[model samples]
Target: MLSQKAKYALRALMMLAEAAPEELVLVQEIAERQNVPKKFLELILLELKRHGFVFSQRGRGGGYCLARPADTITFGQVIRAMDGPLAPLPCASVTGYRRCADCADERTCTIRKVMRRVRDAMADILDKTTLADVRGGRVDEDLLATVA
Candidate 1:
């Protein structure tokens, strides 16, 4: 399941991408346009800024913007920055991994093989999807709005 936090971050980044080559956009504008809560979106944007996904400006014209071109930033990078890993099980993850204690034998477990394939499939998909795709309408913007 995608966390609300991650969804907000992706939407906000997409907004930033759309407005690129323009100046920064205020938090309130991102919140209002994306339909995300102002306060929560502010925190998520700050998190992204801290991770170099974005840069912030403070003053009467204070706002946020992407640090680089949208096409250069992959969805996998944003997802991992916002939510750790894409894998369902930590043991199957490459980054931030933890070996499972009760595994019959990691070398021979069929489930492990299946999970590895699942993880790689997920990674391949998300990695290929970039912020450029999100802003260019190649990816569905309604994904964030569809959360129940």
Candidate 2:
């Protein structure tokens, strides 16, 4: 499950993605449009800006916009930036792997095996699905085939 922060971040990014090119969307506008709290969205946008997902301008007519094209930013990147690794278990993680403390032999651990497959599948889908896919308002045919 995505954390509330991650969900908000995605919502905010989606709004920005749909904006006109180079248009700066006000933070208050994003908060109200997405139904996210203004204060909480400030923190989330700050974090996203730090990650190079967004850039902001100041003064009159100032606000935030995507640092790169929406098609280049994957859902996995945003989620991972907000929530760390997508893996359910540390032992199953690829980027943030940690051995189970109680497991004497990870090589034969059935739980790890199942979780690794789960983690891989999740990564595959999220990493392939970009904000462009979402903004297009239709499922990718290839992705739909894979899901089906």
Candidate 3:
């Protein structure tokens, strides 16, 4: 499940993605436009800046902007930055893999196998879908149709 923080972060990023390349959007403006709480958005923006997703300017005319092109920023990257791995379980994570403490044999674990497939399917879509794709409504319709 996507956390509220992650949802807010994505909304904020989408707002940034819509801005002019050199435009610096104030936190207050972003909060108002995206309907995110200003205090929480400050923390979220700081995290995103640390992850190199955004850059901040201090003082007068200060604000935030995408650190890279929106098309270069994948939803998977943002989600992982805010929510860790896309995997349903630690043992199923390719990026943060850890054996389940109670599992005697991971290779033979039915749950892990199913979750690995789930993780792969999620990564396949999220990693390929960029902020620009989403903001522009360019997501693969056939894929969405299949899912629906």
Which candidate leads the pack in TM-score? 2
Indicate the residue-level lDDT of 135 in model 1.
78
Report the C-alpha lDDT of model 1 over 2-108, residue by residue, as the tens digit: 78899899999988999855479999999998999999998999899888888898999879989988888888898899999888787788887787889878888
Query: TM-scores of the models, in the given order?
Result: 0.89, 0.95, 0.94
Which scores greater on lDDT, model 2 or model 3?
A: 2
Model 3 lDDT at residue 17: 92
Model 2 ranges off by over 4 Å = none
Which parts of model 3 are misplaced by more than 4 Å? 136-138
**Candidate 2 lDDT (Cα, 0 to 1):** 0.94
Model 1, TM vs. native? 0.89
lDDT of 3 at 128: 83
Q: Which 10-residue window in model 3 sums to the lowest lDDT? A: 134-143
lDDT of 3 at 73: 96
- Among these predictions, the greatest lDDT belongs to 2
Tens-place lDDT digits, model 3, residues 34-145: 8889999999999999999999999999999999999999989999999999999999999999999999998999999999999999998888888888774456686587
Global lDDT of each candidate: 0.84, 0.94, 0.92
Q: By descending lDDT, how would the candidates be arranged?
A: 2, 3, 1
Candidate 3 local Cα displacement, residue 89, angstroms: 0.6
Compose the digit string of candidate 2's lDDT tens values, residues 54-96: 9999999999999999999999999999999999999999999
Model 3 TM-score, 2 decimals = 0.94
